[model samples]
Target: MDVSWVDGERRRVTRICDALRIRIEGVARAMTSDQSARTLSAESADVPDGAYSGDIEAVLITEEQIQQRIAELAESVAARYADAEDDLVLVGVLKGAIMFMTDFARALPIPSQMEFMAVSSYGSSTSTSGVVRILKDLDRDIAGRDVLIVEDIIDSGLTLSWLMKNLATRHPRSLQVCTLLRKPEAVRNIVEVADVGFDIPNDFVVGYGLDYAERYRDLPYIGRLRPAVYER
Candidate 1:
């Protein structure tokens, strides 16, 4: 398990991080009067106020909220696993979840084990092709161990569903999922995600680890891809 394959993947991902489409304009500016997101109470249905491109049909979650939720999740995890040892294993879905794994590993409750796997139901295009494969396998030994699968986003749920079944054969003591984003609307695969950070609408999102044609991942914040550029 050289595991050096991750470095090249991250570099390739980094190069595609900056093409997010957020055009600054007078109308959109007027609507987004404030440059910063005003703190909203959890119960407040406060509308989003970031740079918008279209009907916002393309926008899903923002990086700010994701970080906030991640911290909260870490706190919750700390409280839950306080009495346990540092045997938590964090497995990240490749190509899309690499960025999330870095930030999430730092916020885990204890010193956890880390592993990466590349599985996808997506084609070269943005749409789901409904086929999943284990391109890369986990390097860590999960037999009789607690493993938490960290996913960037879960939609259609095909990949994770297949992964759950596949990993079950490994004899892990327990297996649970902690996804950064989950689109409940598109969930068809039969698997239970134990911990979820954010529940976003069913939209095609990019940035903060999501991509469109392999672009707009390092934008710091997630936003909808412009139809002209990605959705067509």
Candidate 2:
């Protein structure tokens, strides 16, 4: 006779416990999301003094953005040379292209050999002198190899143009250009790049292997230089 009431009581208790469990899980998930967000914000803000924060006008491309684009470039370039007989050759223009080259080579799925050429078109100035001089040449001959020119920035395109011509003499089987940044002037230089990570404005930029008077290259992200830093 009282069995119906006992069954009702048990069902009520089960429903209450289930609701509590769902509520607790929701609260826990929310707390975890908040903690993760705070951690990311702190990491983004913790730039070291070597980044030259004081001299940076604004961040042009963020660290995350650069790395993402480089990954994409690596995939595309690797696919292009997937059928190559030998390991693809990565011709890095030294000093500036060092950072991009290392990161890109590591990201590529296909094997690549790194060859550096230190060409100087700008000494301590913001403007390129339009004259290219090779400070260092490739260690091994690139003849009949698939060579990809990895560049940090193509500002006036003078250096890249000269580089293309110079590398042509080596008679590489296939040669192409992949640059992380390209300015408006570079578009008119007639040196077509196979892939460009970002086409930026004509503002003077530094960091991520690009520099001004050999400073600010240690920055993890690319940033526009404060006018005062270069003007002085």
Candidate 3:
């Protein structure tokens, strides 16, 4: 066997192991949240029954809530970059960040250009490998432009950390991050986020372009996934 091929296989196995561990941890945490949600009385509960396709234990953030926050974030972003000499550019991470980027862009009062980059750390897995590969590059040069990165969620913070550093080499006038969700406990690296919509608990959530195995992106609201859904 070729030594290089054997090395590749070993790395593949390592990723699979890491993904499984993260999935198990997520399910355990979700189950706890599910139990807590059950304690809430029906009248006090916000999420109605049958609201999601999967076994959603609780609605973490509703669509109404997200929109309201997005409006506020837009105001802040617009004000900060209002006096900029150059046109603002919004860089959206592909697949996951599409929903947030579109909504955030529309909410901004200032004129801006949009660009996208597709990156992958975990192919079909639930966890980050701390290594990133740029599947697609930006179409336009960002040099001297004010760049804002719109993201759906910041989990471990590793991928975003890598991204910010990579983009810095392009010499943008300014670079900042605006993410819809962030998990403080799960952050392995310190990423300075300019605008954050929600600081949610460390739980595996799906909806609004975030998914588990590429499902549940169409959901309007964010919710904790039922442990059984992923365990299966």
The candidate with the higher lDDT, 1 or 3, is: 3
Q: What ranking emerges by lDDT with the best candidate at the front? A: 2, 3, 1
Worst 10 residues of 3 by lDDT: 35-44
lDDT of each: 0.65, 0.78, 0.76
Clashes within 3 Å, all models in order: 2, 0, 0
Candidate 1 clashes between residue pairs 3 or more apart in a chain or in different chains: 17-218, 58-224
Q: How do all models score by TM-score?
A: 0.71, 0.78, 0.77
Q: Write the per-residue lDDT of candidate 1 for residues 1-232, one digit (tens) a residue.
A: 4467888887556433311111112124323321222222234222255544342343345667778878777676556566665568888888788888888888876878789999878875767787887789998778767777888888877777678767766666556677777775434333456666666666567778777766767656656565667645
Residue 162 miss distance in model 2 (angstroms): 0.8
**Candidate 3 C-alpha lDDT tens digits along 11-114:** 77865654454334434433342121111123212556664644777788888878988898899889989999977899999899999899999999999999
Model 2, 1-232: lDDT tens digits are 6999999998778656544543344334323421211011112233345538789877777899889888988888888788889999999988999999999999999999999999988755877888789899889988778888899988998888788767765667767788888887876655647777887778898889988888888888888888999898
Q: Please give the TM-score that candidate 1 achieves against the real structure.
A: 0.71
Q: Residue 145 in model 3: shift from native, Å?
A: 0.4
